[model samples]
Target: MANALLLALALLAQDSQTGGQAAAQGPNAPPTDEYGYVAWCYGALGGYANLYDRVMPEVTRIEKAFPGPDGVAASLKTYPELRAQAQKDLKTFASAITAAEKASPRPISEYGGAQVKRGAAIWQGADSVSKARLAQMWMSWSPPGDCEKRAKTLETKSTILGKALNFNSASATTQAPPPETPAPQPEAPAPQPAAEAAPPAPAPEPVATPKAEPAKTAPVKAAKAETKPAAKKLPPIGGNEVIVDPVNPIPCAGSLVPAKRGGRDVLICKGD
Candidate 1:
């Protein structure tokens, strides 16, 4: 640990000397080039370290409420001392990039270099607004991929942010709700067969009629007799002959007569 501190101090001292040389060249001389930015990747890692320090307390509190299986609490036990070291790191990194920018021939505006500086400063500031701004700047631009690899290496060597930076292991413990099971669909009703039409009513039975009598042959001697059609006879009630009463029954044409029949008084007709 002492040796690491010595190395950090030495690097800071070298950065200060380089910054002094850049000061002779003037503040607004030029922006940083890709090479200069790449050289400054160490400073960005330092910025991330400071950020880790600031959030450690909240992270600890969260673990207390909802513990993680990654032993984050145990890892962060030396946070106080690590935080102090991180502060020094932040300053050293800031100076490192400032010197790089001064020596760079490219303009700062070309790569949005101001945002990175602001992010570093904001991380040191440790205010809500500063933190938000830093997050925005980090999202706005990225350094070259190689620089990211360097940062990752730094994190691996870091005793502060170490594996705590990896949220994957922690996320694996919390299970997501199973995908919602779809409700069973109702089976469709079977199609019904079409109804058949009723057959036509049976034809009315045919009526029967009496056969006509055969025509009689006319006699040769009856040639003088005039032929006449026989008159049709009408059926009587109950097939009995009908009788009509006389218009006057006060006296018969032959004589007046009275009679009793069937114990009832009646007028008798004596006329031929």
Candidate 2:
């Protein structure tokens, strides 16, 4: 009887252990306890949507006021830094949402409360900065135009913000906004008359021939012949014939004889 009682006690302990294990593994189990994170995500998303909606309408109103569509759009594109910040904020909000969804729902209520607080802080900061920028834009207006149109844009933005913050009854108080000034119309330029075709350049004048001068002839004179004296004949002498010196002989093979003494003569020398 004591052994039987011990066996029954062991079976009861086994059943309790199995039941506890099944309860722990149930489908309704919570995944995580990150309530603060979930609230931050929802608030951030709401804030971003509010900002986007507000900014876009203001931008559109400004464009309409400016009249020149391209100029207004281009001017907005110049604020790349502002646009980048907005995008970053939006992405952060989206990521937070994703993280919260993957987490346990039990923590979401607490997270939402924390997110609301954070959202309110960010909204206040952003609103102040936006107002300052708007003030600068207003200050830039010249004498003929004060920022009445820009003021209307601000009023609209405020309305959007109020709605985003869960106050749907809020409305813009700015009066009936004045219509945009029409741009000055440029005067049409006067058309110039077609120039009368210039008279064809006068036909070139006929070239005149120059008169030729008569040729001049010089007088002719006949030249007279010059008188010459008769030359004396030289007498021939047999031994007086010139003989060339051997050391200074002529290049010919025959020996030279003087045709006349004390006068020029031909000389001949023998070849080796």
Candidate 3:
């Protein structure tokens, strides 16, 4: 602890010397007192650290995990490359976290609503996971693969962690929502000339109403005619007026003669 304080004091002394020649700001920009900001940061970090330790100690376990001859390294790839990528991801995630912290508690507006919804969804998904699960991912699992995804997700939800770690008690200034961009409208179809609109097709010729055959004098007269038997002639008993038989059954319109052919019953038409 004494050594840590000594190191912090040395760093502060160096920062104080460097800040004496700090860069100038724009005419409208508010003047920043770097020493005041640094002092506040120091106090906030110290207070958060004490609170975090009390709630969950074992913080030094993370410090012991350095990739070297004496420390654990990834088995999936060359340790040097893995360690390098891990460092880059760590920095990238840290930047995303800082952005999140700066953008929290945004003002609600119709402008850029979709983006607001998207950010809200990402934060919601981040909030749904238990701290215990996150702790296991960070401290229990083997390194690489899913570790990158978990780290990126955690970075996206840094505001939640900041609050959980007791660093975000006072409300940050509400951020202005982004401006909305309108979707492009489709162009109207080119108008056709009056002649090109096309005239309605002519109505089909009225179907011919077939002349109704005067109510068919006979129901199926042609069929009956087709089935009628041919006339048979009896030996001419009496000219074309062949004698008529009262008992002979004939299928056609024929005269049946009792005078027979040589002596039997037969039928004959008027001409026969």
What's each prediction's TM-score?
A: 0.25, 0.22, 0.17
lDDT of 2 at 65: 69
Error of 1 at 59 (Å): 1.7
Query: Candidate 3's C-alpha lDDT?
Result: 0.37
Which 10-residue span in candidate 1 carries the lowest summed lDDT?
Answer: 22-31
Q: Assess the local accuracy of residue 3 in candidate 2 as a C-alpha lDDT between 0 and 100.
A: 36
Q: After superposition, how far is residue 28 of candidate 2 from its true place, in Å?
A: 35
Over 1-272, each residue of candidate 1 has an lDDT whose tens digit, in order, gives 33332233333333344642332232222234433343344444456564664555565665466555767666456555555655655454445444434443455433535545532432333343344333333222222234444333433343233244344446677778899999999999999897787899999998887789898987667457775545333222233422112232333355434555445454454555
Candidate 3 Cα outliers beyond 4 Å, as residue runs: 1-77, 106-141, 150-272
Q: What TM-score does model 2 achieve against the real structure? A: 0.22
Model 3, position 64, has a per-residue lDDT of 39
lDDT of each: 0.44, 0.41, 0.37
The candidate, 2 or 3, that scores higher on lDDT is: 2
Candidate 2 residue-wise lDDT, 189-271, digit = tens? 99999999999999999999887877777766666666444432233335543345333443344555433235555342323
Please provide, for model 3 over 220-256, each residue's C-alpha lDDT reduced to its tens digit, 9 standing for 90 to 100. 5454445534434334465654544434443435544
Best by TM-score: 1
TM-score of 3: 0.17
